[model samples]
Target: MTEVRGVVATGKGKPVEVTTIHVPDPGPGEAVVRVQACGVCHTDLHYREGGISDEYPFLLGHEVAGVVDAVGEGVQDVAAGDFVVLNWRAVCGSCRACRRGRPQYCFDTRNATQPMTLPDGTPLSPALGIGGFAEKTLVHAGQCTKVDPAARPAVVGLLGCGVMAGIGAAVNTGGAGPGDSVAVIGCGGVGNGSIAGAHLAGVRKIIAVDTDPAKLDWARRFGATHTVNATDHDTVQAVRELTDGNGADLVIDAVGVPQTYTQAFYARDLAGTVVLVGVPSPDMRLELPLLDVFARGGALKSSWYGDCLPERDFPMLTELHHQGRLPLEEFVTEEIPLDDVEGAFEKMQAGAVLRSVVAF
Candidate 1:
């Protein structure tokens, strides 16, 4: 076992601390990653707030770009020194989803059998099965996807989660195309990512909706052809007006609240798709009319991790970023040290930054 410093949230609504932890050598199908960069995501905040679970002393941080430090027996796909992006869902090939050729929806994902723990031997529940806030972490070999080593870690690491989810929501789930008018609600990191995805897919009219002016400005950088200020206009009306009173071909709700979701439901063209990519609270409930659901004549989909197959999508997106087709680096607002996680969280909550990446 090797000692490393990592961010830990010990209790509900508590600030995370950088403390000592122990990482064991990789076992079968496991690998150790020396994390180079990890992006701070809202999910990490959810874990700290006990919104995810009551698992205390949680090891936080997931969206990771790292180098393989070691691999255990039977690991063949990746070896030591490979630069990789870590994904939470490591598809188990034998699972029903994989057997059906839809591995992105793998029901049984893989993680390391051995646990990283505190110096006193208390096992830490790594957030999203990654716990990449440490200098090094152990994970299933399948969780690490080899990407171009030339890509910046801080920029590429964001692809491990929110960015990938947003892009996947638009390109994969929504099937946005060159002729489609795509409207994305929220304009946060994930929202902007959807806009970027639409842009990458050659969408002609990409609309961004948000209450925050700063966020809307950020959305333009990712390629929003139109911006809707939710505070200033009725979201559905605005989107419809922009799309010739027919609504958009696709509407994505990156803000998972009922109001935004309702807007998304109403802001699409007949037979258009509505994709919900936001993470909503458990207590929040929706009461949409069943009649409206039937009348819409379109699909209402919830995107889980953007419906992405990491092995296939990661390399392709990384290549796009390398080719300057996808502006992946624009998502990073700041680079911080491991000790500034709390400050990073504060910045995120205030909507002051798209991403604050911890560079080790």
Candidate 2:
């Protein structure tokens, strides 16, 4: 075991604190990672607020990039020196989803068999099974996906979560490609990722929708051909006008609220795809007309982690960023120390930055 300083949320709505914790040496099928950088994702805040579970003293932070520090028995794919991105969905190859050859939807995922704990021996529940806001963390060996060592840890670490989700929502789930007209509702990290993905796929018309002009500008940097200020105009109408009155071929709702989702539903062309990459609150409900669901003549799909296979996607994305084809580095609005996570959360809530990454 080793001692490390990490951000921990001890109770619901409590501010996270940088405190001492114990990271066990990798057990069988596990690996210990020396974290280089980790992004401040909204999901981490959700965990801190007890929105995810009642697991208090939660080890917060998930989106991570690191180097393998140690590997346990029988691990061969990664070694002590490999640069990697830690992913939550460590697929179990024998699960039902994997048996059917769709490991992205693997029915069973794995985490380190042993626990990370506090000084008093209380176990910490890792946010999404990757407690990365620390100097080092232990995870399932499969969680470590080797990527280009040349890539910046602060930039590529985001692919561990939101960025990947946004990109996958468009490319993998939405099947965006050349000649497609895509509209993304929301201009945050995930939304900009969708815009970037659509750009990568060579979509002809990319429309960005948001209330914040600054975020819309960020969307343009990612790759939006047009912008719609939703606060001033109706979202569906603006998207339709931009797409030649036919609506976008693919509409992504990156904001998980009912209003944005409804806008996405009505803003797609006939037979167009609508992908929901945003996570909605558990208590929130949608009340769309049942007839509309049947008559839309398209698919309404919810994306979990952008339906990504981390092992396959992470390396590919890192290489793309390294090639300068994808401006992944632009996503990092600021770099912060691990101790400023509370301030980072405040900045996130105030819409002050796209991402505040913790660089170890």
Candidate 3:
């Protein structure tokens, strides 16, 4: 086993701490990653708040870019020295989803069999199956999605989660295309990512909605053609006016609240697609008019991880970033040390940053 320092959350609704943890050597089909950069996502905060589960001493941080340090028996796809972006879902090929050629919805995903624990041997539940807030972490070999080494670690690593989900929501789920008008209800990393995706897909109009003016400003950098201040105006009405009173062709709810979801539902054109990429709270309930649901003549889908295949999408998007097609680096509002995670979370709550990446 290898001893490393990791950011761990010890209790529900408690602050996280950087403490010494023991990461075991790779077992069969597993690999050890020497983390270079990891993004502080909302999901990490969710885990700390016990929104994901009651699992304590949770190892937070998952959107990571790292170098493979070791591999165990039967690992062949990646080896030592490979720079990779970690993904939560590493499909088991024999699973029902994979057998049907839809590995994005894999019923069985894999992680390391060995546990990463505290120095006292207390087990730590790694967030999203990736304890990447540490100097080094063990994960399933397939979780390592290789990207171009030339790309910035913090930049591409954001694609490990939120950014990927947003982009995939627009490009993969919504299938936004040329001349299409798209409305993204949120201006966070995921919302801005959807704007970028729509732009890359040749979308002519991208409407960005948010209560924060700073986020609205940031949305423009990602190619949002219009901005909607939700606090000042009716989001649905503004979207309709911007799209010739017909509403947007595609509407993505990146903020998973009932209010925003309702806005997205009504802000789309007839036969338009509505993609929900945000993670909603368990207690939150939806009470849309069943008649409206039946009257909306389009598909309404929830995007799980943007329906993205890491192997296929990661490299392609990173390449686009390299070619100056995707402005992914803009997502990194600040680069911080692992110790500043709590501060980063504060910044996240205040809507002061798009993403605060921990650079080891």
Candidate 4:
């Protein structure tokens, strides 16, 4: 086992601490990653609050960019020196979803069999099976997706989660295309990414909706043709007004609340698509009229990890970033040290940052 310094959330609502932890050497189908940078996502905060589960002593951090340090006996896809983006979905090929050729929805995902432990030998549950807020982390070989080494770790790491989810929501799930009109609710990193993805897919009009004007300004940078202040205007009505009395060709809900979802449902044109990419809590529920569901005459889809095939999506996105076609770097609002995760989380909750990356 390799000893490393890592951040740990010991209990619900308690402050996270920097502590020494043990990372075991790769076993079969596993690999050790020497982390370069990791992004502080809302999901990490959720995990800390026990919103995810009762897993205590949680090793937190998921969106990560790292270099392989060791490979297990059976690992063959990646080598020790390769820079990679860590993904949560380590698809099991034998699962029903994979057998049906939709590995993006792979029901059986793999994680490291080995446990990372605290200094006293208490086993730590790695968040999202990544636990990237450490000098090194162990994961299934399938969790690491090789990206361009030249790409900035802080920027590329965001692609591992939120950014990927947003981009894939538009391009892959929503099937956004040239001349299509698109509207995205919520102007955070994910929503802005959806706007960027829609632009990349050649969408003619992109409307960004948010209560915060600052985020709307940020949305414009990502190619939003129009902005809606949700606090002052009705989102669905504004979207319709922008799209010439017909709703947008596609409407994506990046805010996972029932209200935003309802707006998305009403903001799409007849036969248009509605993609929900934001995550919701178990207690949250949506009740839509069955008659309206049938009258909408369109598809209501949920995008998990942006419906992405990591092998295909990660490399292509990295190339786009390298070519200056994608604004991956713009999503990184700040870079903090590993010890500043708590402060970064505050900034994230206050909407002061799109992404605060932890650099090891």
Whole-model alpha-carbon lDDT for candidate 2: 0.94
lDDT of 3 by residue, 106-175 (tens): 9999888899999988999999999889999999999999999888898999999999999999999999
**Model 3 TM-score relative to the real fold:** 0.99
lDDT of 1 at 279: 93
**lDDT minimum window of 10 residues, candidate 2:** 48-57
What C-alpha lDDT, on a 0 to 100 scale, does residue 38 get in candidate 4?
A: 96
Question: Taking the tens digit of each residue's C-alpha lDDT, what string does model 4 give over 1-360?
Answer: 999999999999999999999999999999999999999999999999999999899999999999999999989999899999999998999999999999999999999998999878899999999999999999999999999899989999998899999999999999999989999999898899899999888899999999999999999999999999999999989999999999999999999999999999999999999999988888999999999999989899999999998889999999998898999999999999999999998998999999999998
What CA RMSD would candidate 1 show?
0.6
Evaluate residue 21 in candidate 3 and report its C-alpha lDDT on the 0 to 100 scale. Answer: 93
Q: What TM-score fits each model?
A: 0.99, 0.99, 0.99, 0.99
Looking at model 1, which ten-residue stretch has the lowest summed lDDT?
Answer: 289-298
Q: Which residue pairs show backbone clashes in model 1? A: none
lDDT of 1 at 193: 91
lDDT of 2 by residue, 1-360 (tens): 999999999999989999999999999989999999999999999998888989788999999999999999989999999999999999999988999998888888999999999999999999999999999999999999999898889999999999999999999999999999999999899999999999999999999999999999999999999999999999999998888899999999999999999999999998889999988888888999998888889888888888899988999988888888999988999999999999999999988999999999
Candidate 1 residues 1-360, lDDT tens each?
A: 889999999999988999999999999999999999999999999999999999888999999999999999999999999999999999999988899999989999999999999999999999999999999999999999999999999999999999999999999999999899999999888999999999999999999999999999999999999999999999999999999999999999999999999999999999999999999999999999999899879899999999999999999999999999999999999999999999999999999999999999
Clashing pairs in 4: none
Model 4 scores a C-alpha lDDT of: 0.94
Task: Report every candidate's CA lDDT.
Answer: 0.96, 0.94, 0.94, 0.94
Could you tell me the lDDT of residue 39 within candidate 1?
Answer: 98
